[model samples]
Each structure stands twice: as C-alpha cells, then as structure tokens.
Target chain A: MIFDDVTAVWNQFNLTERTIEHLWMFSIALTISVILGIILGIILYQHKKYAEPALNGLNALETFPDMALLVLLIPVAGIGEVPTIIACIIYSLLPVTRNTYTGLVSVRPEILEAGTAIGLTEADIVRNIRIPVSLPMIAGGIRIAIVFTMGIVTLGGIIGAGGLGAPLQTGIVLLLPDVIIVTGLWVGILAVIFDGCAGMIEKRLTVRYGEW
Target chain B: MTSIHPFETIDRIELSHLTKTYGDVTAVSDVSLDVIGGELLVLIGGSGSGKTTTLRMVNRLIEPDSGIVRINGTDIREFDEVRLRRNIGYVIQQIGLFSHMNVGDNIGLIPKIEGWGKEQIDARVHELLEMVDLPPEIFSARYPRELSGGQQQRVGLARALVMNPSLFLMDEPFGALDPILRKQLQEEFLTIKYDIGRTIIFVTHDIDEAFKLGDRICIMHEGELVQIGTPEELIFHPETDQVAHLVDANRKYRHIETFTVHDLMSPLSKREFYEANMPVSEAMAKILSDETGIAVVMEGNNLRGTTSRQNIVRNRKKNLLLGDITTEPITVTPEDALVPVLQKMKTKNASSALVINREGEVTGMLIPDSVLFHII
Candidate 1:
C-alpha cells in the first residue's frame, strides 16, 4: 500500500520541477507579503488616522475569495507564478499587518515613559524598546500569513503555475484518486512543518522579551 | 585635593513661576522653590499633585508652558536638551535596564556615548558595579532577565552613575521594590550619596522615604509647592495643613535629632572630681548605678568620662586599674543631631554616648533611656 501502482503515477509525475515551482511561488509570495506587511504595519502603528482605514481595507481583502483574487490579478500580470504570487501575497497580508499594528501600540505606557525619562531619543525609544517588545506578535502575524499563503499557493497551480497542484488539478479532472490524495497529503505536511517552526520562534521570543 | 572650581561652588537650583498645561487641565501651576547644592531635595505629593511634572520640568522632560529653571546662575533653557540631560543622572521606579543588552553594556552606555576609550569605559563600568555593590564579573555579563528586581535596580543605579553626572534625578526608584529590599536600597543610596556628593532631586509619594533620604523636603499639592524645608523645620513647623498631614505619618523619623545623646548631655559642673590615678575597682563602686546606669568619671580638675555596665562586664579583672581597664568612650557634641548619632550607634554597635565639651572633657553622660524620655 505504501508503494502501490499509484507510486508509478507519482514517480512519472515530474514532482521535482512541480515542487520547485511550487516552492518558488510560495517564497516569492512570502517575501512580498513580509516586505509589504511590515511597511503597512509600521504605517498603521505610527499614523493615528491611517490604522482604521488600513485595517478596514485588509478586512475587505480577507473577505475576497482566493480564486477570485487570482482571477483579478490574471488580467494585470497574466497567468503563471507572477499572478499566483501576487494573489497569495494579498491573501496573506491581513493577519500580519493587523497584528503588528496592535502589538506595537499595546506596549506598556510605563515602559515607554521610563525610556523617555532616561533621556532616550524618540528614535532610540522605537529602535530599542517599542520594536523589540512587539516582536513576538509580529512574528506570530507572519506565521499566520505564511501558513495561509501556503494553502493558497497550491490553488495557484490550477492556472498553470506548475506545482503539485497541477497534478492535483489534472487528477481531479481525470478522476485519479491516488495523485490527488498524495499531493494533498504532502502539501498539508509542509504547511504543518512550516507553522510549527514559526510557533517555536514565537515562543522563544516571548520567553526572552516577557511579551507576546 | 584640587582646589574647588567656581562651578563646584554653584549649588543652588531654582524653578520660578513654572507652569504646564495639558489641554484644559493644568498639571503644574506657578510653582517655585530653591534647592541648595549638595542637598537631597525630595518632592513629595500624591498622584496628580504635579510632583512628577515639576521634577520633569527641571530636566526639560516636560517643557514648562511658562517659567524658568535655573541651575547655578544660568537658565536650563540655554543648554541644549541632549547636552543638559547628559550632565544629569536619572533613575526611575521601573529600573529600565535595556533588556537587549547585558549588564556591562547597559552600564557602559553613557561613557561609551561620551566617547571614552574602550579601556576607560570598561574601568568605569567596573568601578560603578562595585560602587553599587554588584560585582562586575558576576553581573556584567548577565542579561536583564537573569537578574532579580533588586539586582536590576542596582544595575540601573550603576548605569545612572556611570557618567559621574553632577546631579541625580530619581523618581521613586524604590517604589516597586518589596519593603525589606526598599530599605536596603535606601541605606545603600545614602552611602552612595555621601561618597559621590552629587546634588539630587528625588520624587517619592512615600512620606517615610522622603524623611529618611531627603536633606530638604518639598511638599507639593495640586500643582503647587506647599512647603520646602529641612525635616526638622517641616515636622516642628509645618507651613500649612496639607504639609502637616503629609508629614504626620513620618513624625517619628522626623524628630530623631531630639533623641540623640547630644540632646541629653548636661553642661559640666564643679561637683565632680577625681585624681588621674584612681583605681578602676574603687571607681566602679563609687559611681552610682541607677535605671540610667553608670556615672561620669572625672580625673583631676577635668571630666574623663562615664563607664557603662557593658564596659565593666567586658573588662573583668580583680586589680582593674582605671588606666588599664577603662577605654576613652565615643561621645557627641551638644550640637550634633540625633539622626547622625543614631546612625553612629547603629554603625558602631554602641549603646549610649558621652557628651563632650570644648575642653575635650565629658560634660555629662547620655544614656538611651534619657533620649527616649525626651522623644516621648
């Protein structure tokens, strides 16, 4: 059962190139999400008026269906990893951006007052106390985003982005249950592994900073 | 010692007509007071009474909407904010040692920022750790999480003192500590102050702490100074009902000068005399022992001193020559305050004091009971 005739189908499936493309798409999406999310988070934290609007926009983005977002991006960037990554990044940004803004703002007032009283410059306060203390929540947000994007990246393969999802889409149309189950299992395992690692990092940061 | 510089002599600090408003609420209003150099002046008030706001205005942490803060003869506004803050040491109740850095790095920050060489900064950090009773080798490499609350505070003090700034601004540095730890830190701060000789502006809501550490206390109410004076001046003569209530809790520690042996010491009289060669055994029997215990010992035309029961018990021998068995006792002059005398008693582990005169002779012996009587 471990290496049934389904193994033959999987072996000839070109899983290597598909997996690489999948990883490429996932990485591109993650990188873009992290960069854009952090910028948006910092802006939301620093700008008193921007938080509500930015959060509302993110909530609206979250409500949009993943397939619909991919469809929306296709017209702009065309089919393939580019549109796939863009759609996945938009899907992943909501949690990270919102969590980062909340975390930075919720730092204890006493801690900040102590920093100011000790003659720390405004920049020093941000660099030294505010950022470090808010790091656990920031990391948590990123973790959630990564796991959410990984699930979405597989669906991107439906549009010819080239991943395990391509075989998955083909298996579904061709009624090949073996390919569908194997690819789905592997992707699920990868998501769990990635999220577990991020959870560990968040735990360590919390223990160090006495905050989360 | 190098000759004192002109700047060293400039000790006075004055905040005149200070005011601060946050929207509709005024935090401080028209507050003014002069603090002498080398004095630990504590600002005591309840929460929202403007004590912290007033302290903040001195260092320009909170810009006063109006008024001037003068240090020596110059206004603080004349100095750049960064440069002014660099010249003053600040410690707070939370003990905010940077969690990211190890102890040595935190303590070395000021000297490093001041552009000292690596060797000098390291040496200064070592000196400050020892001064604050933390061994550098043990604590310098440890991060803030590894230390206890009290240890963190000690490191905080070391960090504040690292630059050897001329003035210290402490905002309830012991407020977060447990009672026993708070007492220990207060005692340690006193020793540090005596050694460093820095003018200190301290803020505390605790009346007992204000009395214990302050050379002069400034009582504030609703954004204004209620009264400012020495502890004795505040206790014996409070200027307002608010000050009296503020000090009422600390009246016992406040009047410690009255309980000193100096207060009980009687002036020398011609009634007592003895030859220099008097036998110790005979002298012990001749001196009357009462509830107060022991009598004064006069040699020739001068007063030698009193001998205590504890002294006799320690030097027990049959022959007991006065010169052999009797030791010259420690005494205080009439002008010495009871607090210092009590401090000496605690430090030297002594039971009583001898009052001495201008002629280097004992005027009278002062026992603990006599001091207690006067205090009660």
Candidate 2:
C-alpha cells in the first residue's frame, strides 16, 4: 500500500520548489560558514598562540548536536530557516576552519623564503603566495563543510522551514509511509547531488592549484 | 678570466666592521671588505667560518649586531630593507622555487612586483628562460614538480636574475646538484658572470670552486678573515702557514719571472719548431715530450731559437746553453742554493737548470747528472 502511495505522494509534491529551498539553505549557510572559517583560520595561522583555544572552541562546536544548536537558537532568533541556517553554519565551521589553518601554516619554509626573496610585499605574499598555495587544502575543507551543511539543512524542515524534510517530518507524525519514503528519497538524492558538485569543484581547484 | 671594465673598479659593496653573534656564538666577527663593481668576490671557509653570515648582511637578510653595509657608497640601512633586497639577487643551494607557480610565473614574479607591464614581463620571462637554457615554449606552463633538479636550479637562477639586480649573493648555488651537473652549471654560470657584469658575493666551502670562479678569493677562518687575494698571490705569497696550507695544492710551483726567448733559448735549428715567446716551463715541457726531443723556437712563424735536450747533457762548458741539457732544464737565478735549486728542479719536473742573471741572460747550466758525477 505504501509503495503504491509513494508514487501518489510524489505526484502531489512540488519536487522542484522543495529542492530549490534545500539547496538555497545549504549554499547560503555554506558560503557564510566558509567566509567566517577562512577569516578565523587565517587569524589562527598568523597567531599560533591563539590556535589552541580557537581550535578547541571549534572542536567543542562540533560536539554540540546540530538539532540542539537549532533549538538553542530558537529562544533568541526564534524558529524557521534563520535558526536552521545558523545551526548549519555553526556545524559546518569545524572542517573548513581546521583545514584552512593547517594548510596555511604548513606551507614549506623554503617556499616562504623564495616569496620574500623575490621582493613580494607582505600583502602580495599572503594573497598571491600563501593563499594560492593553500587553496586546494582550503577547498578540501569547503567540500567537507558542503556535505555536512547539506545534512543539517534537512533538519530545517522540522521548524516549518520549507524543504523536502517538511513532508518527511509530517509523514512521521501522520503515520504515513509514502510521504516518509518519498521525501527521504528526495533528501538522499539532493545530498548526493550537492556532495558530488562540491567534490567536482574541489577536484578542479586541486588540479589548478597544483601540489607542492 | 673575464676582464672586468676598468672604469667600474670602484667598490660596489662595502662591509665595514661587521659582527654578528647568536647567543654567545659569533657567526661573523668584525669583518670589513670591499667588493669591486663587476667582480665576483668568493667567500670561502669551513662551516661556522662566517662566510654565509657575512654575505647575508650585504642584503640585510641578517642584520649585523654592529657594522655598516654600504652599497655603491650609500648606507643600505638608509634604504628600506625590502627595496635593498629587491636590488640584490639571491640564489641558494636549495633552489626555493615556488612549487605552485609555473616556470614563467616563477621567473617573472620579481619583475611583475616591480610594476613591469604584462607584455614586458612576459617577454622578459621568455628571455630569462632562454638565458638559463630552458626553452620557454615548452617550459613556461610546466610546474616545478615536472622539472629535474638541475632544471629547477636554472629556474631559480633565472628568477633571481629577472629583475636584473646590480648585486648577486649566491650561497653554494650549485652545491645541491650532482658533481657532473654542478661542474656543468659552474662553467655555464662563469660565462653568464662575464655577460652580466654584476658584482657578486659567492659563498662556497669548496676551495677549488672558490679558485675557479672568484676574481679574488676571501678566505675566512673561525669568524675571521685569514687573507684575501687573487688565486696566484694566495698561492705564491701566502700571508701565513694557514693561508699556505689552504692553497697548498698550488704552493709548490714558484712563479718564475717572465724571461725573453733570447735569454733562455739558443738560436733556431731546422728541426720541429715551437713559439719563441711561450713560457719556458711550457716550452720546455713540450720539447722534452716531442718526438725528436728538440724544438726550433719561432717568433711570428720565423725561426728564432733552437733547444735540444741531448746537447746540454754532452756539453760541459761553463757557458753551456739551456739547449744543451739532456733533460728539460728548470729556469732559476744563480742566487738560489743547491738544495733549494734541486728541490725546485724536482718540483718543476725538470732535471737541470738554466742559471740566469737579473737581466734574464743565461749565465750557465746546472745539469743533475754532472752534479751527481762530480759529487761521487
């Protein structure tokens, strides 16, 4: 019966609109998290004394469950896509920040010497030499954040944030197998597609950036 | 052996009273030296001898604890450190090429930073790659990982030269390459040195390399300069036992005064001929090894003098000619002692002497076989 209703529910659902909302939340959250992560990462890289506390803070954020983070945000920001996106951003910070920090600090000393010896100004060294050299590793972090953010964005539907997770959460409450199965399938398919796209972008960046 | 321009003889770089210490260990101590424009001054010493520290201070890479670095008579401290460095090309043994950048980008970086136009930078990059013997068409797009060690070193050299800096500081630039490749690069760099005519401070631990590439070698020991002189002077007139020991390889060969062909040679004969004005040591070596063991000395292709090893052995006249000795005779002045003369003869690979006066006129001959016969 659920197998037959699965097609029925799919026919009634606006797959295009729901999928757009899912990706929109994931992308915006990922963009915000990546920018913040990069800034924090650079700060940590430049001031190694602050790295331990900053890294421990990021690690602590990772231990806090995404659902609990969203619930905690409800008191201040209230419910819906805003808190969901905030939670997703917080959850995604660990990988991007850690990778960027590691990548920047790990650039070989000889390479830095060459950069300085060539008369590159401090700004030029950071932007042209340090950043470009560390891009691939930073991209790796972004990829991980993309996948992790996509997972947390699914939970956005529980707080009336309109995404594929909405119908899936509704299905669980109404005891409807077709809604659960069909919405779950959509979420799974969207996650794979988003992850695949992120992976392709990271691969392209790694190829262009080259290995040391 | 490239002759530097006469007008460019002014001191291009001067290090006055330089001293640097690292936690009670003096890396370089009270060193003052002037490097003439267009001259390659090679600083050579064993590890911890302060050669590298002395070099780095010129570019202010390592600021001295107490000293002054003057470039072209201007205090380097007055200029911004970055600007000072931009004018000084630096190459080290470990290459340090940017792995992220392709060959063209790596070489063009300094020029680009100096605000060179894009097209001009590109052209310069191509020209530099060609100078380093790397084809730009094929190598421009290739990353450093795609190249061999020697190729990477060439790129490093090109990168340093791209800005056409007036001074170059090279610290064992070819030391990382294999022996054969190192020698090949050294020879190639020597040719480039003449063409560029930039003042250079080359730091190397290899005494032989210092002798080969340096116009003047500065030998340092225990953070102090032991001596600084041309290779010939260092060998012939070493200032101390340490200086003599360092140049011991060439110390045994005393510098013979330049004698005219008429002084050390006799009149020409009809046999095999050689240049009359050639160094007697060189001419004697040739005659001794020649098929006939005699050579007619020629001046501008005309027969000027003749020498025969056999004639000197048979002739016992007090005024015997240099040509009369059975063995190639060493040329020496008569003030020399017998033992020193014998030792000098042995070192020169000769068995007799053409004893000459202050005017380089041949006074008599010292034949070893006759001396041995008379003594017995």
Candidate 3:
C-alpha cells in the first residue's frame, strides 16, 4: 500500500525532472568550489603570514546560516539557481581551502630538504613534490564539499530552483503529510547516493597518494 | 660519459676564514682548511661544533657571514648556486629519497632537470645503480619504502653520484644504519672512493667513522677549527687538549691497531688441554672449578674446539661427549693484526679466538678478557 502511495506521489510531482535539476546544481557548484579552493589554498600557503587570519575568515562564513546565505545572495544575484549555487560555493570553501593549505604546508621537513638539496626550484618543488603528495588531503576536502553541495541544492527547490525540496514545500503549505514524507525521504536517499560516489573517488585518491 | 665537463675541472677546494653566527651563537669560526684533489677529507666534531655548518657553506646552503670558499682556485660565489649544487653530490643521514618516486626516477631527476636526453638519462641511471649494487631491472621500479634501510641508503648514494660530480658533501651518511650495515657500507664506500677519484668532504660526529674513511681528518670544537691532519698525525701529535681527547677516545685500544695477535694473546702453554671424548658431567665439574672456566678440547692435539662453564652447564644431565657441547672458535694467525681480529670477534660475537702460528701450531689464546680491556 505504501509503495503504491509513493508511486502516486512521484508521478503527480514529476520527481524525475526534479532529480535532474538537483544534480545540475550540485555538479556546477562543486566544480567551481574545487578550482577556487585549490587556488586560494596555494595563495595562502605562499603568504603564510595571512594563512591563519584568512582561514578564520572562511570559518566565520561557515557559521552563517545556510538558508540565510541563499536569502542574502538573492538581493544581489536575484532568486533561483544563481543565488542557490553561490550559497553552496560560499559554504563549501572553508573545508576545501583549509585542507588544501594544510596539505601544502604539512609536508615533512626532510622531504622539503631533499627537494632543495637536489636542486629543485621553489616552484618545481611545490608542483612535483608537495602537490602530488597532497592528493589525498585535497580529495578529502572535496568529499566534504560534495556533502555541502548536495544539502544546498536540496534547499534550492524552496527558492524556485525546482528540486525535490519544492514538493516538500508544496506539501508543507497544503498540510499534505503523504507528499511531504515522500519528497523528504527521496531527497535523503539522493544525498546518500551522492555521498557514496564522492567517498569512492576519495578512496581511490588516498590509495595513490596517501602514505607519502 | 657525461656531456657536462664542470666536474672534470674543479677538484681542489680551499676554505679561507669561514665564520657563521646565528643571533648570539657562532656556529663556525675562522675555519680555514685545504682539501686536496681526489682525497676524502673528514670533518669531525661533537654536536654544536660547527662541522656541518662549515660543509654547508661550501655548497652555499648556508652562506658564511664572512669567508671565501674557492674550488679549483675560483671563488664559489662566481658560480650560480643552483647549478653548483646540481654538479656536487650530496648525501645525508636520513637517506631522503622522494617517497612518490621509484628508485630509477629518483636518481634520474637530477639529470632530467639538467635536460639530459632520455636515453642518456636511462643509461646513466643504470650505471649508477649498478655501481651502488642495486641492479636497474629489479630495483629501478620499486618504491623506496619497499627497500630495507641499508638498501635505501645505497639508493641514496647512487642518486648523489648520478651526476659524477668532482665533489661530494656527505653529512653523517651512515650514522643511522645498524652497526653491521654501517660497517659494510663503509667498506663499500672505501672501495668506491678509490675508483671515483673526486674531492670529498665528509661530516660525522662519530670518531671511528672519521678515522676509517678520512685521508686526512679535520677536528672542530666550540665553533673553532682545532687541527687538520692525517689519522696518524692527529693520533700521534694532537695540537690541542681537545684534539688530544677527541682522537684519544680510542687510544685505550691504540695498541690494537699497532700490535698483532702475537703481541697480545696469552700463550696456549699456560692452559691445560682436555681430550674431546671427555664426558659432559666431568667437563662441567672441571670447567666450573677451574680458574679460567674454559676447557680446550683437543682431538689428538688438533685443537678441535673449546667449551666454557656456560656451555657445559646446559648438558650436565645428558651423557654427551665434551665435543658435543663444545662450540667452534674463530682461528687467527699470530701475524694477523689485532684490528682485523677485533672485527672477527665482533662479527661472530665470539668470546675469544685461537691465535695459530705457522707450522700448524696453536701457540696462544686471544681471549676477549685480555683484548676487550683495551677495547672497552
């Protein structure tokens, strides 16, 4: 009887189309976040004097309420997917940047000594040694970013981004418990699926570059 | 086979009035020394003695506050630091091979950075790997952690020598190895040191290491150069009290180097020998009551073996022949130098060795009791 009811809800709301929109937002936001995070990390690693303060500022951004961030972006960027995607990136930056910077700086001292002693230029050492060995740490940050991205994209439906959250919103306004339960449960399942994929990718990266 | 020629030229090195200071601590002071071409110069000192600081200055790793380091009669400052380092071999105690790199890649990095053709790089890598006793086909693809500590250090040595540089700067290269491995590497290095005629400045806090490898040893203390001379010169005519004490560390065993087994062993005639067929219980009682706690087992005076109270005590209840419990002892010639005999003692962990003279005669017993007194 529950499976029949779930199918009825799924068709009436067109959950399949909603799922596509949700994935589109997540992919875009995570891609942008990974690139920006790595660049910012490199800058912070080079300017060690500002690394703590800069990371602290990003940490403060993390403390801002997620929905509040989407609403706040609405004034400048208008509503819908633009503001939603921006919110996801803003929330995801701290973990990725912090991890990238820590990975670059935390390379063992003797490894650095060997690099210099063997005549690797400063930039070459960063490129060949530090970055290659830091793959696992950067992968971990991206994994955390994937979780944040998924959560924010789900909330995107409330602002007319039309994800699974929209049906839950519809059910909430009309007080229909069946629609609410089905959409909420479906979004939770999608999050777990996305997180599982991210975890698999992170594991592969760890195997290649973790121990060094 | 190197297309580069910088190494073939600069073989002599001269340091003039080198001094370095960090805040209030002077790491090295007025240290001037000359290194002959193709000779290994060992710089030795205890911790904080500035020996390492002095070596680093030559490579411009740590620039001196005031000094002139000339290689082949030209100032080192005249050469670019990056190129200078690439051309000079460097090895350290940590054996800092890049973990991400396989053995071949690690050695090939220096040449690759210098823009060598791939075939040339591969050939040179293979040659150097062979030189260090790690064959290319088997070991080249293996990661550093896949090798043991001794094997890793050999790769480190091969990596440094890949450039075939005229100069080498080694800092405590074997200090981290176990004693057996350390001794093996030292002997291998001595053999390699002869085949590759290059100027070398080796840094070590270990006195024995310094004496063994150094063509001439330079001693430093409290940021100052105390003396520089051959091992014989430093040991026999120490210029300062600190130098005397530093080299005199092994003076307790100085006779070990000079004297032979003939000069040091207790003659065998002083002891009573026993037949090999003696019963275990009887031998145990005799060895326990004897003044020396040792019984030399003879097969018709052929010196079959020897047993101690510790050896016989375990077999006292068994009806075994004395020969069954007796352990074989290392044999040495009376003309054999005490230094090699001492090495034999350490290798087998033997309590003593038989000092055999010519004409198949066992003339004396070189017990550790007599020699270890000087050794300890």
Candidate 4:
C-alpha cells in the first residue's frame, strides 16, 4: 500500500496543474535568464571599463543568499513567475558576463588585426571574428549559469512560484517523506536534464567554432 | 616602346626627405628615393635599420614626421585615408589572412568594401584566386585554417592586390617562409611583377634577395639611407666601407662582363695562318694571315688576329708549323668572374684575350683598349 501510494503520488505529481505551473515558471525563468545573461555578457565584453565595475557589483550581489534575492524581488513583483525570472536573470549574469568578457578579450591580437586588415568593419569584426571565436568560452559560461540557475529556481517555490519546489516545501512542512522523495527526485532529474542540454549545446558550439 | 614621361609615369613613387620618429628614437631619417614607373625597388638592411619603416611610410601606414610622399607627383596625404590605403597595396611578413572568413571572402574583401557588384566581386575573387595560382573551385570555400603557410601568403598577396593598386608595399613578405618556399615565392613574385608592372617597394634583410629581384637596391643603415643604385653600381662603387662589405659579400657572383676581358688580353693582332694542307702563299692571301711577322690563329670559320708581327718576323723558322710559333692566348668565357680573369691575365703576361664560346670557338678579340673603355 505504501508503494502504491508512492506510485500514485509520482503519477499525480506530473499531472497536477500547480506542478505544471511550477515547471512553466522554471522554464520561463531559465529562458529569460539565459537571454539576459548573454546580452549582459556581450555588453561587458564590448566595454572593458564597464565590465570591471559591473562584474564587481554582480559579484557583491551573488554573495547575497539566493533566497535574499527572491525575497527582495517579492515586494516589487508580488510572488509570481516575474519575480522568479528576474531573480534568476540577476543571479545568472555574473558567470556569463565574466566568461564572455574574458573569452572575447583573450582572442589573439593578430587574429583581430587580420580581420581589420582584410577590411572587416568594426561591426563585422565583432559579429564574425570576435563573437564566433569566443563562442566556446561564452557557452561554458552559460553552462555554469544554467546549472546555477537550476539549483536556485527551487527556492522560488518559497515565494509562491510553482513546480517541484512547491510540493517539496509542502512535503517538508507536512512531514511526508514519500512526497519529499518524489519531489526531490523530480528536481534532481530536471537539474540533470538542464545540465545535459547545456553541455551538449556548449560542445556543439565549440566544435562549430573550431575550438579544441 | 612607349615613352614614359617623368611626370606622367604611373606607378612612380617618390619620397622627398621623409622622416619618422617615435619619441627619441628615429625610425626613418630624411630618406628620399624615387622608384620609377614599373621598377622593383628593394629596401635592404639589418634589423632596426628603418627599411620597413621607410617602406611603410610610402603607403602612409606609418606617416612620416615630415616630408612629402607622392605617387606620380601627387601627394598621398591629399587622398582620404581609406582611399589612400585602397590605392596602395600592402603585404606584411605575417600573412594576416582573416581566420574566420573563407578564402574567397578574404580575397574579395577589398572589392566588396569598394561597393563592387555581386557579379564583379565574384569574378574578381575567382580571377585573383587563379592569379595567385589557386583554383577557385577547390580553394574558395575553404577557411584560412585549412591552408598551409605558403598558401596563406599567396592569399594575403591576392587580398592586397584585389583593388589592382599601382604601388605594392611588401614588408619582409617572405621572411617567415622556409628557405625552399622563400625561393619559390621570390621567383613567383618576380613573375608576378613582370606581368603586373606595379611599382614595388620590397623590404628585406637579405642581400641576395635584394640583388636577385631589385631593379634598384636601396641600402639602409641606422635609420638612414646608406646607398641607392643598381646592383652593378653598388657593387663597383659602394659609398662606404659598410656598403662595400655588403657588396663584397656578393662580389664572387658578379659576372666578368662587369669588367672588360680586354684589360688582360694581348694587344698583338698579327700571326701566321694555315689553310687545310695549303701552301703558305695561299694562306698569306687571307688578310689575317698575310703579315709574315705575325702569328695568325683559326677561330671557327675565320682567322683571328695574330699575337705579334714582330714575333713571327724574328722566328722566321719555316715549315713554320702552325703550333710552333703560335702563342696560346689567355681566354675567358663571358660568364667568368672578373677577378679570376684578372688573375689569369696577370699570370699569363697576356696583353689581349679571346672571347670564346663553350665549344672553344673565338667570337671576338678583347683588346687593351676595350678594358680602358669600362674604366673610363
């Protein structure tokens, strides 16, 4: 009967509207954070002076607990997917931004000079040479950000965001070990899936860019 | 056979007292030279001698601190920066081919930048790929990463020439190549120069390369122009001991024609001549054999001048075997070195010499007067 209950909870977990909503919230946060993180990374790469100050500020922000950012966002965004997404984007910005800046700047000066001498305009150089050459490093940063965001997103449930985190929080409050184990397993599986996807994409980008 | 006016000659590059300084260090010091239309000017010197700086100044890649650089009498500074760069082709030691771009796009860059139409750019790319000895179909789609160093250099040259610029500035373009590839590229560059007829300001530290390729060689030393002249002029009359040492290193290769064979040949033109088993009387009928007091020699179809009328007169010993009284004159082929010829003449006490073909046939006589002509 215990095994039946556990199986029933497992089947119901994926079907529940709140669980589905939580998954949707996690997906939205991940997607938005990745996009915003990449944009910020590119910005930091283009402006060296801004990179130091901005990265330092973000480093300071990262030192704060993830729950602190989640709680801080609730007053403004009112406990929904918006607050969760904003929090994830902010948290993910550091790795992606730092990595992109480092990668772009690390390109050999001769390679950039070759591009310029071959008559590539500044914009074309950035788009074609600098960005493509640095894409491997950028992808690495995004991979790190994805894993970090995945781990942190579960905390979003504390602020009324949905997904496996909500059920886990409830299971812990109600002392339901079966519910906790099921929800924890789902979160673990989701993190592994997110990590695997990021790793594959990073590898593909590295191969495409001719980076070893 | 067209007349090239000094003023109207296209591809003529003139640097008028050009100077460049980086802080306290003078990179190029008041160097002036003219590379006439269609001439290859080689700038050669050791490291930090300003040969490269001087070459770059012509293209305004390194703007001179002072002085005018003109192309066909028009100041280069007068043109817009992009326009000026487009008109002067530049190739550096590091080939600098864009790694991210395909070979065709890299080669087509200048034309595309100039707003050439799609058809024009495509045709230009293919034309240049073939011009550089690379087939377009095979190489066009490949990236720079797929090419060898030599192939990359060829593509770099094609990129430089995409706009068909009249002046080419090459800064140690072959410096990084292996010796064999360097020689090959040098030969190919010479052929390209002959075909294109652009004014080339080629920089190198190699004296052999300078002599092999330059129509005019400009030697630089310590940021100053030491000497500028043709290879012969520089070899014979180097301006300083430094220039002399540079020329002296190449002296062994300078041909004998640079000095006259006459300087060491015998002055006598009289000798006895013999016809195939003929009587002396008939042999005397030939003007070259007529003089009794001379020793005539056979050279191919005609009898050459005798050694001396006096020697034949004194020996009047008859049956006068042709070999008996005939003095074997010192001779040299046209390709022999002047130093060796001089040493042979001094050892032989010869007043005149015979210019002979490979088959030992005399083509001409080198008299003492001919030797004086070169010196005077």
**Candidate with the greatest DockQ versus the true structure:** 3
Residue-by-residue lDDT tens digits, candidate 3, A3-35: 899999999999898878878888899999999
Which pairs of residues have clashing backbones in candidate 2?
A: B267-B306, B268-B305, B311-B324, B312-B324, B312-B325
lDDT by residue (B1-376, candidate 1, tens digit) is 1221213433799989999999998899999998888889999999988998998887788899999999897898776666667667889888777776688988886566556999998898888877775657667888888887777888999888776678889999999987645755676688789999999999999877887788888988888888888887887687887777767734444565455455655454444333436675455443322212244556665656555433443343456655454456667876677666766665675545677767776676544422222223
Model 1: clashing residue pairs? Answer: B257-B338
Off by over 4 Å in 3: A176-178, B1-7, B249-251, B254-376
lDDT of 4 by residue, A94-191 (tens): 88878888877887876766555444567767777788888878888888877777767777778777766777878888898888887787778878
lDDT of 1: 0.75
**DockQ scores of the candidates:** 0.19, 0.40, 0.44, 0.15
Model 3 residue B142 CA deviation in Å? 2.1
Per-residue accuracy of model 4 over B1-376 as CA lDDT, tens digit each: 1111113335567889988999999988988888888888999999999998887776555788899988877887775555565666788888777665688887787676657898999898888877766657768888887787777888899988887877788888988987545655676687788888888889998876787688889999989999999887887788898997876534433454565554443333323334323333233334222322234465545644444433333333355534344566676775565666655665665544567757755555543322222222
Ranking of models by TM-score: 3, 1, 2, 4
Reference-based lDDT, residue A181, model 4: 87
lDDT of 3 by residue, B232-317 (tens): 77776888878878766455565556877887687766345777898987775565335354677888859788775545655666
**Model 1 stretches astray by more than 4 angstroms:** A4-6, B1-10, B22-25, B109-122, B249-376
Q: How far in Å is the alpha carbon of B240 misplaced in model 3?
A: 2.1
lDDT of 3: 0.82
CA lDDT of each prediction against the hidden true structure = 0.75, 0.74, 0.82, 0.71
Best prediction by TM-score = 3
Q: In terms of docking quality, how is candidate 3 classified? A: acceptable
